[model samples]
Target: MLVYVVDHNGQPLMPTTRGAFVRIALKEGRAKVTRTKPFTIQLLYETTSFTQPLSGGTDPGRTNIGEAVLDAGGEVLYNAHITTRNEEIPDLMAERKAHRQASRRGERKVRQRRAIKNGTITFPLEKERTPRGCEKPIVNKYIRNSEARFVNRKRPANWLTPTTNQLVETHLNAVKDICRLLPVSDWILEINRFAFMRMEDGSILGADFQNGRLKGYPSVNAYIFALQGGCCACCGKPLIEHYHHIVPRHLGGSDGPENIAGLCNECHGKVHTGKLSLDKLGKAKKYAALSVLNQAIPFIYDGLVELFGQEHVHICFGWQTSEQRKRLGLGKTHDADAVCIASLGNGSQPRQIPEPYEIKQFRRHNRAIINNQRERTYKLGKETVAKNRKPRFEQRGHSLESFLKSLSPVWRLDACQVMEVSKSTRYYNSEGRCMPGTVFYRCRRKTPGFIHGDIRRQGPSYGIMPFVCLHIILMQASRRGVMPT
Candidate 1:
């Protein structure tokens, strides 16, 4: 039999006529017999070779070794009897399968355990039974411990009678004293008494102590009690000393505690008179005030001035007011409350107006109003910007092709240059049939239809074996301004 080996370029790779029955050993350790019978050799030559052999024979009479295979005139024979060995193939596959199965089993066990822990599976407990010689379970039996007696059954009626209550209270107070003396006593006598009393009455006392009760105000009593517990109304701090009105009473606002908050002195002062505006209060307080104002500006403005001092207040009667209205050359006949001016002390020089009392009063009343307007405008602008921002390209499902198209011309040109280099190498080696200079060796242990294989080359530059011909072609075309579709 005669055999021939070829490289990726379809060129005759070995020395012609050097040997017969040529054996090609692939890098994956698989060897194939290309020539076997005399008849097969005749068929190969007649169908694939461009020349004819001098005589009919199974042997090519030469050793053929090279980088590519060529159409040599010869009586070539092929066979299917070649065998390759790879001992680790089956073991590796078996190990992979075992690992996969174990992982699946572990996942299933974890899911089952989670289900059971989450009460998705409920198992009935087995009924308890004593041995034949043991006594039956007893009802209404009492077990005595060091501190108390535990009853096996429900307690009797009349557990909270006046006489019993008095006796229990007396004993409980004494026990409390004793616990205080011992310090390390296991019994919590007061807790036990409270629990016993609650259980006996089937209800709790003092739980709704402030229910429906007014504390000199028309607001919800619960908030007043909360205020009394030291929570600040303006900042929700826990150490409040001053009570702030959401709407000042001077503007016909109610004295209801709901509209008032218990605030610390700092928060109270910042509430209306400081740079902080009513609008800058936390969301909870802001929403609460909005509910009271019913979106009315007159009420909101009045509330702002009352909480913030008039001197710093900037708005009144729907306009800004300041002490320097005359210095700006405004008419004296204008209504003092209707005129608009900048707030006095926000780095603005204080003007010496004729009436000091009126100036001081205006400063005290307008501070909060101006700050509130500024804060509201700032918030609106921020929200508008957030709503109008554009979506990012990555978030828009851009494909690789689209992304490449969007790159700058210079980057595209560079990519084309790279592609051209690859394409040149691919076609240069293959004689228009298969890419040359590279060898693909299939694993003997692999399944017949599997394409998994190692890439190799016969030349010294084995470093670049089995090049991706398609990538090279496309890259070349791209460089030439003819990119692949």
Candidate 2:
């Protein structure tokens, strides 16, 4: 394990695993421990500072983000995989809302005595029409009594869902921390954009070329044409190049890059006239999830440039990083991909990948009870706390000696004597009623589930995967270190 160090001013220094150097510094009182979790320390005495050019690579995902920093020599320095709580946030929020609603329902009682003092005789009444088409007075028992919502709301411009915002924030914060800890001169973000279905068909239109939902492309067309080596796609001829839709427009085919291709007029005519088939043209299916994440590219780019300066940050497609990892024969992982991105400018030198420490964003358990958490019931019908229960005991009042005293001078005291309970002395509540030595009987009381120690386990029919259904199988597989073979 390497111990992270910082200068007197808290600026980061290269990590060191040299035990003697650290021990000497601590023994000489030159350094003081700063953080125990990561075992980091800061130098108390001034020290000369030296840092090398480093690049930061970030592999952002929906659930986990991988970060890695590499020096100019292509050495892995820092590696971490931060698991985010994107999905949990919403669930927590829902729980909080329920708690708040319970609070509004007047569940929490203060000091017990306060409840007695403030108990209301009746709820406020509201007049309303009844289902029988008659106006009648009714209690307004449904009052939220908390806060009134506006009842109408609108989403603000550039709005992002809570989960997405959290994800973006996680990525930004992870990147920011790395920048602060390392002398990051360049930032390489591996953002892979897939054409998905369009690319698989090989007929997709170029950005600068004529297109429909696929916008016009300037240099993107050059890349597409380069793929064909300036030769017509349909006819091997190098003359009279024209873009044509493989599938007819009336058939719901789009002008997407995968649906259009470079072809000679003769081939284009033949394709439109149904003399040629797109399937015969080698079209294949490609699956890619292209959505909000792709749009986040510009947003993330702007953020990086603002933090690291536009000149220091560079963008590389995810495929490029994947290719680098394949060439280096590195294991497939988020951290390995990050290393690939950082090594994009490192040339062809063989570099070792760093081991990543996983950081789980687990929900810390709160000792406080969740509000309005009702007990689960086997069979239910308005189960409530039964009040006015009479205590049952086999013996009369406390002890026989106390009962003897209550008698004679009170052989048979007035049956009108009511039990007077006082605060427990060395015991719980004790009343001077039940007139000593009177026989008692046993009465059974059923405690609510909330106070019970245990209950019978549910049968196998209940299953063990209630929560598991919420997880996407593919995502769970990825998290389990499994490759989709």
Candidate 3:
């Protein structure tokens, strides 16, 4: 019974008797050992002595000696003086260890090769540097371009050949010559036509040539040339001109020469000012004629105010100015309206509610107050005017009460299963501790009137109580066939 200590690979690191004692000591923490073999164990004792067989026969002295030594309290010395030969043990352990080492080396080599192939393992291009007080080398990696490039060292793929380049240049020069044949205004008109050209035959050149023909007409040429010179067509006034279309595009008029006309700036202004009856031209041509005039005017401010209302026109102008500032890389600061609270009643009491009889009387008073406040604000500083104003809750007038009462008749409906708002609960855990829970709600209504209208705010706010109000109005109106007279 020879004892041996081996590593994961079954390599013997120590011989029998001494190895057993060392193993026990290692287990007891009195000694320590490391092995690449799979086995780790402790032995109770080690000695060399003879033992009799159960059949009453004496065993071989050498074979029984190992067991006898283990049975005794005396420690067996695995010294050079006492040697036992076991040729296979060393050979077997050596073979196993070699096989395992080869396997590990092969695995490591495969990983390294893979890394190199994938470019993960790359040689550093930058020089190594050490910190001011440190001796360690600091490795740095090289940065490369992210864009894809061809492997060829010659010109880029999209670069034109010398022959193609010459051909393009020749064609471009020809086009320029043809463009020069036309006046500047005609050139602009041709370009506009080219920009908006639509294909009839689903062919590119056909559409472009067709549009060019239309733009090159004598009538169009005369109109555009006169327009470019800023001469009014109605009176031949050189002050300014407006391009008025005979048939308005919005009313289904084409961009044909026969559909276009010109007007004096004054006449155009009068038309939009409602002094002239545009209805005389028919609704179809009215908008188209207006559009043409708008385009011809040089002053954008006046033209925009004429088209959209003053409020919307101002907003558009503000947006345009903002965009221009951004393009020029300039910052803008605008003063915003400030919010202030004013108390109308005494600090102790709620605001008074006007009686039914006093409603008409208070109406006059309220209008007067509002008018005075406006006038005062115009005369005084903003801060002073705000300080002077008071916030008063007005009584609900008969009209307002009637409006509320009308709403009471409308029914409120819960979301149907098909369009219900779904909710989910979630629990979180971190670092072996349970965290707080949370609930998430998702609304799934897609159609209009799923919610009420009057109280409903459009857009994102439509999903709340306002939605319910809107839905009620829609349902009630549909049921009663009540036109909103």
Best by TM-score: 2
Evaluate model 3: give its TM-score: 0.18
Please report, in order, the local distance difference test score of every candidate based on alpha carbons.
Answer: 0.32, 0.60, 0.32
* Per-residue C-alpha lDDT of model 2 across residues 358-419, encoded as one tens digit per residue: 77665544312422233221111343211112222453233323433445665434311432
Task: Write the residue-wise lDDT of candidate 3 on 1-485 in tens digits.
Answer: 33344433332233344655665677786533442221233223343322211100000111010000111121221101111122123333455556666655545565666766677754664546554444466653332212222333478654543323332333223223222211111000000111223323345564465565446447664755454465654456765455666455544555554455456778788766877544434223223323322232223233334433354321213333344335434333220000000000001111221111100000111222222221111112222212112232552222223323433343212111122212222222223221122111223366565232322212344343323233445456567553221
Which stretches of model 3 miss by more than 4 angstroms?
1-211, 214-240, 244-260, 278-485
TM match of model 1 to true structure: 0.15
TM-score of each: 0.15, 0.50, 0.18
Worst 10 residues of 1 by lDDT: 57-66
Location of the lowest summed lDDT over 10 successive residues in candidate 2 = 450-459
lDDT value, residue 121 of candidate 2: 20
Q: Give one digit per residue, the lDDT tens place, for model 1 in 1-485.
A: 13344333232332234343332233223333333322111112212323321111010000110000111232112111111112223333455556666655545555656756676532332233443343563221121112112333456753443322332333333323222211110110001012323443555567533433464455454566464676765566677676566665444344555466666878777777765555432122222222222223233233334533344233322223324444455443222211112222122332222221111000112222222211011012223211101233444433334444666987866643443111111112223232322333322334443232222233343232333465554444446554222
* Candidate ranking (lDDT, best to worst): 2, 1, 3
Candidate 2: list runs displaced more than 4 Å.
36-38, 93-157, 194-292, 295-298, 345-350, 365-485
Superior candidate under TM-score, 1 versus 2:
2
Deviation of model 1 at 344, angstroms: 99
How far residue 282's Cα lies from its native spot in candidate 3, in Å, is 9.3
